[model samples]
Target: MRRALLAITGLAAGTTAMVVLKGSPGAAPVAQDLPAERPTVVPAPAGPTPSGGDTAGTPQPADSTASPRPGRTATRAPTSRPSATTRAPSAPRTTTKPPPAPTTRTVTGPVVENEYGNVQVQITLSGTRIVDVVALELPEETAQSDQRSEQVDGRYSGSSGLVVQRQSADVDTVSGATATSTSYKRSLQAAIDRAN
Candidate 1:
């Protein structure tokens, strides 16, 4: 039969190479058969050691106070400890007075020509507060007078710059863009008469 099927496939490859060279019957113990011991070194004291002068290389407090010295690592002692009682020195602080300099200003107005064309406004201020009313020349000649001067410069220049900022340059006009709200309130009353 082909030499007995090649001798039963060489006896199942020599019994899987002798169970992979006879290894695992559990397997762990080999560091020179194991039992050495000597690592106890302790010595960490440093501060109050002048007592018996020759404590060799000083550092000995570890006889296992619940195991911490195998390479020395303890550190956490700062939970708020400063109260021996002498605290009477704190009264010198009254300085509080600095906030007045922003009267801001910026004017520009007088171009009022109109019939759907030259307006000009600017304003700004801040302290007498018109804050911001910018229309710097409006009616752009024709796309329906530039879409009715950008619909009264965006809905009556913010409600006529908050009514000429709380009624300052005397307010009114903006109804249906009444001639660009009376030439934007006569160029915001010549920039509120040059900001007073």
Candidate 2:
């Protein structure tokens, strides 16, 4: 096996060396010739050459009624015509929507008591829209409860409040703290009712 492997390695090295040396160094270099300049020759006009004027190959204005020169055909000028399919004039667009007029107000909710403790929330509104929801009180029966309440409140404080306000009291309860969510929503709904 070792001898076979050594033979394979030697074959690979020999193949690589042959490939590396395959290109011929004595190949002739390609010749790159510079482009030659050509003189510009404009064709003479069919009509009588203008005196002392260089109007060779210059375009002449079309004269449809004029007779064609000998051996040359007269070209007619193109006439403009209306399109076969005419588009109907577009109607002016109209909007009937009234502009939004937001009204800002702040209202506090009634305290809601659940199995954990009392929960109360204060809500800020702009017209019928709820702008912000703040917790006035939260359940904290024990030290652990207080810590859990703090963590839950921090997580849901802004985002959860916005959800409840926009979605109303029927929003989904927060995971791992259903009781807290229920109590908070109850209090928030009361506050929203007061604002309305």
Candidate 3:
């Protein structure tokens, strides 16, 4: 694509130069930006040599090794032509798509402290759906508190747990574990909020 554009722009500039500097045969080349050297000598027009590139003012040779078409004669055609193997490129056709972002992630809520102990919750989510909940910490200060924490953890945290089944912090509180249950729900809500 780039080479084609350069070729086209080069030819346009060469045409403009020939028209503008018609009589000044020795003036600078008006062909497009060739490097220190041009790709090849393009054929000159039939009317007369452009003086932009073809050896200035001199009559160009009708016979040459570059292109020796039998009928070509007398015209100031350039000596070199594009090689046979060189072909114009076509635009690409494939479409590209980027991979999708990960949908499953785990989020941990801040540790919430209450009179009984500190409670922290973690939740795994698949897109907007809650997949599981886990109790990272709970009150282990006393035997009764430990049993209550276990009761709360068992009721609320798992793949098929009540928390996932309810999909919210509004699970039924255990009868004797009100404080732990409330703390657990608070931590779970915070984790869910952070995940969203």
Candidate 4:
């Protein structure tokens, strides 16, 4: 029983030593990345030929021993013929797509710090004409105290109402806010441009 136990222990130790020497735990084989072995093609051994590899230099006699057989015939030489040439049709033709329409609109205003707050303009355009115009976020205090009122007459230069004339214009600006009024007027002009 003692000998049998010794033998089993020795076998386990040997197996563990082999595994460590082979580096099998998460270690790749040394020759795994090398290119695969392939068969080498060797050219056949050739002997020297007569006539110096050229049959045209020296013409052999008809009845000479070096001549070919009587029945077999040599192949004919290759020939070259005229190739066909095609010409495209001559015509003034063009196929092009039209440019896309502009879909974005923008409005500009001034930066004015009034007694109430900052001032900015609001403009609304419909197509090429000014459809709507308004002051952006007016102060509640100014609206109550100003009491601005005006009557403006508009006339078209031509038969179409493309142009207009303001007969009477009344405007009310903040106590120290002329810039705010200018910004509002700029917004109105932007709206008019949208209308045209």
Best by lDDT: 3
Descending-TM-score candidate ranking: 3, 2, 4, 1
In model 1, pairs of residues that clash are 43-59, 43-60, 44-59, 120-137
Tell me the lDDT of model 1 at 131: 67
Return the TM-score for candidate 4, rounded to 2 decimals.
0.27
Q: lDDT-based ranking, best first?
A: 3, 1, 2, 4
What TM-score fits each model? 0.26, 0.43, 0.49, 0.27
Clashes of each: 4, 1, 2, 8
Report model 2's TM-score to 2 decimal places: 0.43
Point out where model 3 deviates above 4 Å. 1-102
lDDT of 4 by residue, 22-134 (tens): 88878877853432232122243254436457645444434323333444333334567555665566898888878666344444344345564454444444344433333
Q: Which ten residues in a row have the lowest lDDT in candidate 3?
A: 33-42
- Candidate 4 clash figure, as a count: 8
Model 2 lDDT tens row, 63-180? 5477755544555456787788877778989978887788778788899887788888876777776766678788889886676567556644564554444546566676767788
- What local lDDT does model 1 show for residue 116? 70
Q: What lDDT, from 0 to 1, does candidate 3 have?
A: 0.84
lDDT of each: 0.71, 0.70, 0.84, 0.43
RMSD from true fold, candidate 1: 20.3
Runs in model 4 lying further than 4 Å from the true structure: 1-88, 108-110, 115-117, 124-134, 143-146, 149-180, 186-196
